[model samples]
Target: MKESEFIKKNSVFWRKLKKELKRSGPLTCRDTFPDDYEKVCYQIGLSRQRGYNLELIDSLDSLALRMRQELYRKPSLSLHNLLYQFLVETPRVIRGNFSYVLAALFLFTLPAIATYFILLKQPHLAFVLIDPANIEHIEDMYRDNAPHLGAPADVDSRVMMFGYYIKNNIGIDFSCFAGGILVGIGSIFFLVFNGFFLGTIFGHLENQGLGYNLSLFVVSHAPMELMALVFSGAAGMKMGFSFLIPGPYTRLHSLRKSSLIGVKFLILAAIMTFVAAAIEAYWSSLPHLDMQSRVIFSLSNVLLIGAYVGLLGWKRGPI
Candidate 1:
């Protein structure tokens, strides 16, 4: 094969090597280029001597002898570098754990618990806990009874109900996830208390025949709200688990490593919570659905939550 034709076929490889040679003097041909060296030289058809002569012809005489030595260059993968350095590295820290999951459940149950005892034994406390003035603007709408337009009368009520559900439910979800930092117990307490409250509230609503209304309001936003909160709690629980099971690392190291698993979820949950709020605010309030429809919608929301958790509910790899 002609020198020029050989050069054309291996132009890219040769150009790169030539540039490296210019920056760092050429290698000697006698010292076998690491095992891979011959591949580069043979491909170019410029035997080490021919290359050395060519370098000399190009006015780089001093590099000729050095160029005779075959050189082996390390190859790199930019795709791998980019992915490993950023995306893959991030998820390593943000994982899920049993503790976080439990905590989230506990926190979500708080409302149910409060709704229980207070609904019967201490009815006043239920009123207080569910509509605590301590919570910002907890009684704002009830107190104001502000008029709403552009929707049916029931629509506004449904919307308000959905909003209330999201606000109340999302708060507990956040608590469950956040509480995981307390080594799972925090999350546990959060879940138990919240779940209890929710159960009790529904119980009370059921007795009053308003359960259907509540169910309808809940369906539209609950999917997003519940998932977001669960994710947050899962993150915290993962952190707690890290600390508890340090494995090869020190307690602090393990905790730091594990804590990273839930970060993306935490961020996503916060944003979803807000979207849920908007849905409650604008769409869910228009009470267009009847009782059966409401029940179906609520079930759909529950199903959606189940599916999402199933998809991203566990840790599959080492942190």
Candidate 2:
């Protein structure tokens, strides 16, 4: 069939799909979505195969991409919905916005690595990024005879520590995310500052021969906790980038759209931080876990979290 005939035949279907795609309300089951999606996919391939006009091909391509974004973006609240969100939507969003996440990771880790090495060479300079008074406290916490970073305490004390962890880390996460309003400067500063701050502590402890205790204290929760930073930082950058490249939308509209996505990343960060707090309070604080055990536990965390974000929900469906 000719291109015009092909379009004329499917005009009603394309129009209906376009209307559904532009709906502002929650997407419900029309039971025709799968067929609509598959047909659109076929039309796209057919258009390209037949060397149709660029406009026809572009419209179909854009529609397909938006459909992919919305495929698992349901707003229902149920046990099944929650499971689906975690197993599918979360990873999909991560993969979709993964470049920002990588940028966040790079901005965070590069400074950390640089600071750790610099401080290791010149241990006295730790006071630049770390507080002078706090250095002694850290030494006391990780001293040879009394390593106390995550020292065992009563159940009540552990609960308090858990609360403290949540409060502090989430505060940082929020700052990293909210800083997007400042065109991402705030997020970058916080990530870089925190990196240097933590690196200073690590290098200073290592210099003082207290690295062993610190390793055991942080290993188990570090992966998830650090990923919270990545998520929030990336979210903020996403929001900030809206102003720089609003694309076809108005500035406010683009910001609103990007902020919605940013909030999803923040939610992921919050959940991970909660779990990190639990680990830090209960498991990481447990005394006498061997170095080998700590290493293994941390490795497992890395593998699990990495695989979940990198592997699951990987394929972009036609929807």
Candidate 3:
């Protein structure tokens, strides 16, 4: 076509393009223009070869406007996909027997509760259970050539009392947390055994007249330690449940997901255990602590446990 004749023929088209550009400030050509500035120049070169002065509008702002419009357009979201992912994927994560871990940890408390009965009958056991370093003086009633209770206070037994607490508490917490894979059976067994042992030991101490002193030492820190164990149990149950009822995903996939949750719980448990150990070592064992002080520490422990349980419920209705 002749240049003048083609220009005349496309005059109306050019007018419409100019009008759109004036209204939308260069975004109008978003459909036709290339997003990249260099690419837009390339297209303009082609348009000029076809006898159009598209170069007259070559600028960064024009190119950027076109690019933004092209990049911003997206398909609308609908309820179908949202519902499918929520209904199908979310349940597999939420529904399961996480309670078993808590139940198991609760069982561990039994030993602590029952120790009194043993301590009353077998006064010797109090000395046996009393940490060797904490025992005040040597006496004959202890069968292992060990010091009996009611002996003079040693006042200066230099050992890593705190270190022992940390090591034992951390180890037990990890064991309980990881053991949930037995579907809480292992954790529960461990908790019950520990609880009964601890209870009996304390009971023994109370029978021996050292109970108040020991209470001043333990009540401050045992709360965090016990709560940490319960959290660990929850972590383990999380893993076991994932294995038992892996809904849509293969067992392996479910295990991987559950394992992650387990790890998170285990890590939190470990941190709490460490905190408890620090408190037990430094704050709880102060010499000559009074009754009011002991009561305050004991009450604080209850609050901590209650707060942890509350946390479990706060996130979602208990797993």
- Give the number of the best model, judged by lDDT: 2
Ranking by TM-score, best first? Answer: 2, 3, 1
Better of 2 and 3 by lDDT: 2
TM-score leader: 2
Candidate 3 local Cα displacement, residue 23, angstroms: 49
Which scores greater on TM-score, model 2 or model 3?
2
How far does residue 33 in candidate 2 sit from its true spot (Å)?
Answer: 25
lDDT of 3 by residue, 122-172 (tens): 777766776654544411233222231233324343136567877898898
In candidate 3, stretches whose alpha carbon ends up further than 4 angstroms from where it belongs are: 1-101, 118-159, 245-249, 308-319
Q: For model 3, what is the alpha-carbon lDDT of residue 213?
A: 58
RMSD of each: 12.2, 11.6, 13.9
Q: What TM-score, computed on C-alpha atoms, does each candidate reach? A: 0.50, 0.73, 0.53
- Of 1 and 3, the candidate ahead on lDDT is 3
Q: Is candidate 1 or candidate 2 better by TM-score?
A: 2
TM-score of 2: 0.73
For each candidate in the order shown, give its overall lDDT on alpha carbons: 0.57, 0.85, 0.60
